[model samples]
Target: MNKTLAEVRTESGYTQEEMSKALGIGISTYNQYETGARNIPVDKVKRISNILNIEEKDFFVPLKFTLSKIKKDE
Candidate 1:
């Protein structure tokens, strides 16, 4: 199974506040992204992937699978 953004962040030992500051965004905004309440922009996604030391593709593959599954279900 793929790890979530929150999982990766936690494993990397970063608090939401710290991540928000690093991203130059608000804590609420970061929380929203982590909680999937908002879609993170590609630029920010790249920054996040870099910060987490993971490939940028990690963020997108799960979403692609989910979208494809949803389409198939519909």
Candidate 2:
């Protein structure tokens, strides 16, 4: 399943700049990640989880299996 980064951010009522600031990343970099133009780093992934008020594992479910595996391990 393909994930919708744009949808997630918008639904959380955040603009690219807000997300960038919250994650301590450049706005352009956050935009690229949301637009599928760049890969999101693992550190940013954790930050995104915090910003979106969701678990990191849930945030990544549609994009990967790693999150699920981590949850299982925990």
* Highest-scoring model, lDDT: 1
Question: Candidate 1 on 1-74: residue-level lDDT in tens?
Answer: 98889999999999999999999999999999988888898889999999999998778522333434344554
Stretches of model 1 off by over 4 angstroms after superposition: 61-74
lDDT by residue (tens digit), candidate 2, 16-61: 8899998888999988887777788788888898888877776542
Clashing pairs in 1: none
Q: Give the residue spans of candidate 2 off by over 4 A.
A: 1-3, 60-74
In model 2, the worst 10-residue window by lDDT is: 61-70
Q: In model 2, state the lDDT of residue 2.
A: 47
Reference-based lDDT, residue 27, model 2? 95
lDDT of 2 at 36: 73
TM-score of each: 0.79, 0.69
